[model samples]
Target: MSFSGWGYVWTAVMPLAVLLYYFFRKKYKDQHVASTMFWQELMKEIKASPYLKKLQHHILLYLQLAALLICVFALLGPHLTSEALEGNEFIFVVDTSATMLAGEPAAFELQQELMKEMATQTGGKPVTIVTTGANPEIVLRKEPNREALETAIDRLAVTYENAKIEQTILFAETLIDDESTVIHVFTDALDRSILANKAGMAYEIHGIDQPLQNVSMRQFGLAKTEDGIRAIVQLVNETAEPVSGKVILTDGEVEKTANIQLEAEEELLVPFEQLPDSPVWQAVLQVKDDYTADNSMAAFVQEASTRVAVDSSLHELVGAGFRSLNVEVDLMDPMQLRKAGGSPLVTNQTDLLAGQMPILLIGRNDEKTHRVAGAIETVPHALFTYAPFDGIYISEIYPPFEEYETIATIDGEPLIQLSPEGDIAVLTDIQLTDWPLHPSFPLFLWSAIGELSGTDNFFGFFQPNEQRAVALASTRGEWEIYKDGEFFYSYIEGQGAFSAPQEPGIYEVVGEGKTLKMIVQLSNEEKTLVQGTSYRIGQAEETAETAELSIVPWLLFAVVFLLLVEWEVYRRGNAHR
Candidate 1:
């Protein structure tokens, strides 16, 4: 407890008025007009004071004194120094996710305002500006200039992906000071999971006012169907009001627009009867709104005529082998396939023309067969091939064979080596002389086919030379790993994915002896410039806890206490009246 102005204690003199009132209070004696009994009682009741009247109303005197004491304290400017231990190092977390774009003026607007307020409150203390989203990034570290911080805040843009608040919080925690540090999080209330590890520091949450009206295209994809290409699009109307829009689809030349209406908080499913046969097309929702990013999307449809053309013998042999071994294959002849097809495949012309598949050309001795085989490869399928009879008297090599993968031979010759998706089991330049006569020929062929046909075994599960830790939750008591429908390994409950086979391939994870269905694919889009967002901080709500003592202003409480005492004193002085 302290006083801002000790000299103002002189103001305490005004409370002495209570003493003066006690001294000057009027005294009266009753005169007996007719009743002698009343006169004698009044004479006996008269009390004597040396220099003042006896205003011995204890409660009123105490109350008056208290009110005057309060006034003097207010005038003296008394203040309490709490001596709270606060960290000097500051971490400023700002949310920049797609959901922040909702509402009028947007939730990010409040984020901008908070950045300024935080700057003022921080009093030029060093601050690290952390942008939160799917990929939480640190824009500036330990910045002192408020202007520079404000500029960074205004320049911040919303991420298309959702924010990963938990990971960001963990990252910020790493930078917290051991002594005293504050973690100020500015965001629309996302999720509270991010608060799990906030043990060491103080946290100030600045929540944004977000608008609820929004319509978003949540999911969209194109899948091949028996009738034609099947297109599925999903939309969610997040707004309370009803929403209506036209879904515009275009495959460059051909365009189809469908009207759609979605109730608030409702999901709408739009299915295309016939998908466009173009290689590069776009799906757009023509809804009028401020946010245009989620309104439209671009897609690359696989080619139709493009295929992995195999010789009749190899096709029959490999197709039967794969079926027997449960290797999935879509077997069809290019010429015959087009004639019997119900709808065309491969619609995006810019990316891949119709009727094209990435080809895996095998041994073709004749020119006619070679042309037939080369035509199936897509024009730009990133080609690699090997020859069985290069030294033999074969007339013309195929034209597209110019763009093939090769290596220098021992004789300084360019021998084509096979490296399909980096699997080493298949060697490309197998000579015809070695095919029927070599001792290792049968083993080599079996290995080559197995390696070529088999997809990357460790693709979805593990990266090359990477040891990743994974925790899988299952309802069953036990879990198992499977590759190509064969059992690999099993583990007890609460066991991590570390002990499972490190080799990567599509692994079917089964729980409790029942197959838990999930598919993992090698994501080429993972390297794109845009990263996904994550939700870390959650919404704030009133909890069933007592009010914080720190929130009450002591000066205001003192003033109220004084007023109560003053009221008692005033009432006592007026007793005679």
Candidate 2:
């Protein structure tokens, strides 16, 4: 048995003080007239003896000593020892990341079975279960029934999102109420150092020791060519052994196949030519690998619409920017464009245009100018990623537009703005500002074309469990999301953003008379099949035939009872005297 309050054991010597008082205690009494001579004789006899007297068999003395002994025992904080598990509460932390889905029987399945076995051995101890993912979740909480634990274990599933095991473990640690609780972690990528830093937390880490082999599609895209669309596929072998596979490319109707071999941990880029026109293309790798989640990938092929129409006075400058990026430019007069109604138009006029397509407004044609001097502030947007407004001077600026999102501001005045309809308006003229002389001018124009053409925001690739704002033409109706041609969920209007599925695949978001396709893939860290470090931490030094149970409360109760009995014995003895 262990004592939590061993320092208090020194209080056991307190009973020695009571014993000394009893041994040297003196008695006094008043007597009648004849007692002086007899008292003198008795005092002389007492003076001849030692100052310390022997202990007598008095009930009060025995009772006081017994009470002190019980108090000393209580102070020592005794505990009972039994042969069983130490803790009364068990907490299980399980990882649900994509890597757990590898191996023949799968690491997640093995973790489930192991957890259930340990839970059964707990002998009806309260158990809490937590899962790790992009967001950690507590699936079960403080359940004592064995049947409930098995049910919760059987319902456990794995996700394709990246693992946040350390965060989840810390989250679980907050729920512990005492030191008797034991935490059990089951994961494939948990670092041992994460648990070591916990100091005094009792936990055991269970890791999967099985071998894993996987080949993933790192990148897949399509580009329009002179003859037809071209498919680009990049594959990486995550295992240590060489692998051979057949890459199959399909456009829903036509199929193209290519055979390739890759060395250990090698990456290969394969290209497919002369593919028929299709809205979506899919690539599948037919190989024997443990993980199948990353074997196939789908992408929406961009339409042949890399053409921009310019009707601004600076048409030559805008045309030069588009042509530099291999994009065709069509120059048109402002009067002609007003009458022709062409889409994706670029003009400098402030008046409303005829077409409903996206437009890039350079600036107003007014002759007025305003001098600006201060640090420029830019909003966090995709346009500012490559084209920053640093080292540029603006001598003229226009009034800020209230209906547009201000991208850049100087002294709280809007300089660059974007409308909800995907149109961009540069409030200052290039000739009036020295920005055109800077390198950011061409990059700004390139990004502006992509924004107006719906190439950067409408549809693209995303990572698993990623949340992105929905850039739709209209946000007034319910949106439907589908995965692999099956309806998955419905999104309400004005929600503004949507989280991608935890699994990797192609998803389509349909709403407001628009259909947008997005491809979700696993992260680079999740793609590699490296085994994580694992070991137990803060485990108690327990014997095979002993489990400790605190008995301090019972000892305290005995001390209280003994003090009451001693008080009663002293009161009764004094009443008789």
**Number of the predicted model whose TM-score against the real structure is largest:** 2
lDDT of 1 by residue, 197-267 (tens): 55545676666533344566655566666676667777777666787889977766888888999887798
lDDT of 1 at 538: 25
Compute the lDDT for candidate 1: 0.50
Which lDDT tens digits does candidate 2 get at residues 382-486? 576567799788877876567888878886788888887768888877776777677777777776776776554246667777775543334355778887679
TM-score of 2: 0.58
TM-score of 1: 0.44
In model 2, residue pairs whose N, Cα or C atoms come closer than 3 Å (at least 3 residues apart or on different chains), thus clashing, are: none
Looking at model 2, report the run of 10 residues with the lowest lDDT sum: 539-548
lDDT of each: 0.50, 0.75
